[model samples]
Target: MSGDEKGPVLQFATFQSSVDEGFWHGLSSLKLNKLKTDETPISIMGFYTPCSNPHVSSHLTLLAESLPTEPSDGLPTATTHGNRNKCSVPGTLYNTNTLEGYQSLDKKGLLQAEGKKIWEDIRSGKAEEDSSVLLRFLVVSFADLKKFHFYYSIAFPAVVLDPPATLVDLRPASEWFTLEEAESVSACCNEWRMSSLTADVPFFLVCISSNSNATIRPLKDFKACQHEDQKILFAFYDPYHGPNNPGWPLRNYLAFISARWNINKVQFLCYRENRGFADLGLSLVGEALIQPSQAWQDEEHVPKVIGWELNKERKVSRRVDLSTSMDPTRMVVSAA
Candidate 1:
């Protein structure tokens, strides 16, 4: 896809100021410390049902199912994490199709040689019981919130899926975990592309109404989840709860990450009558925004965003109306 179709993509490291700079440094420093990461063994991975995002679910499923038989493992190099003779999890998150925990400006060239066997086991469907599981780390989509700030800054603990946790109830009233203290990051939005308009468009905050994972309690006790010994953060959002204002649910999402580290939450425009979920930002990581151009206005690619409130049954709705947000003349996204 052309850059136009890609929209105003922000390299996670490409921050607007020193704030962005310090963020990357903290992440990088943590990765290199053997004392902090070696035993940590952070095997990050996540999955969403077809309903939350058909495109992404399809993309992830296709990759998982399309795995060619395990290829030969590349030999490990002399390089080690810091001066200690140990390796961290997967080397880098740079250029990973999914966002979160990645460094786009990485010039030293980090390679993921460790997870090849685990990756194969996962794809082959006979994942052996291992300490790190299948993925070396997590996989959150850019379409979720359109930026990496939140996954790190605001949604720190929510970033990874702890499959072993005693799943939290996903219902609105039942789905909030509070942090005693959490650092707040600036909400940043990237410029998006419009198929019909020549001027720059912006990213829309499309909230999630439902998802397949809703049934599981990945968040455990609602206070935190654990994959082994590590304490992880999680928040299950209600489709129709109050998200317009950053209340407990929204603040709780930030708190989950904040309890671990300072994370940056993002700001976005609600395209509809602003009736979408504002109760929590948990939906941001699961949202799908597919557009012919970066503008997210193409109808063909414009996904159906279905949601429901606690007081009512679930309903399907268009997250945005191209006719309202972009040039109506040729606003519809054609599949052709």
Candidate 2:
């Protein structure tokens, strides 16, 4: 099908960030922008515990908050490097409160619970029932996304797996499209398996949580670079325990990209760094700025790590320009 047929699929899915609604704003409220060029008619199952009062929708309202990001150096604080203290993620596209909400849910069993339901839905064909509750995915931007490729980042991979029979359907805070499921729905993932995705639209399913386990494994006989698209579809597993801080994790990310082939473009939105950008193979990097009107949790300056091939370097670039960097593209990657 063509744009004339399916209409123009959204160029970006901007999950909006707002504080007035507080933490549990529901998936619909997270949306920030919509392209008005083309028109298409659009329209959920039970993946969340229902709450009539938005004020007390879930544990987010009770446990999470839009904490501020702090300097890793120069600034001093008694706060430790964990979720128990104040924290926030960097980036204009982020919702600080929503991230806190997600972090809170990770502490609970919401992710695992929602993962099971999502798997059940895919197996039973009830995906539309809980569509509204499932978070909307858009091409807001991400680190290291390349032209003609679909780059994926699994910040928290637990929710994508079907939980053990003992933990089936626990009514988690939200449901999400899993890694395997994402492959199932994407034409770009033909290496993963056959596709069941609706043919015309692009997909970007994102989730962030404070959950980090050393035992985490993202391998399923599928690798990020193995996309049928033959462009560059890289997937990263960021299990950083401390929020905002990027030293250990960012160093690891730089090292990880250094080992990969042709991955030169990188962008990051972390809050903390133990060393200067020079430590991460970045040079002459400038702060990527964002508008306060469009700011989620603005950082003083966003830096680009520059140089991935010459020095086997992985330099971060400016923010991802959704216009060309990301698309469901012609690359046909698939799922099981």
**Tens digits of per-residue lDDT for model 1 on 173-291?**
11232221110100111111112221111111222212311211222232322223332222222111222221112222222232222223322222111121121232222211222
lDDT of each: 0.22, 0.21
Tell me the TM-score of each prediction against the true structure. 0.19, 0.17
Off by over 4 Å in 2: 1-112, 122-229, 232-336
Residue 307, model 1: lDDT of: 11
Give the alpha carbon lDDT tens digit for every residue of 161-204 in model 2: 11100111111111122344332322222221122231111111
lDDT of 2 at 286: 12
Query: How many residue pairs collide in each prediction?
Result: 19, 27
Evaluate model 2: give its lDDT: 0.21
Model 1 ranges with Cα > 4 A deviation: 6-112, 126-214, 217-336
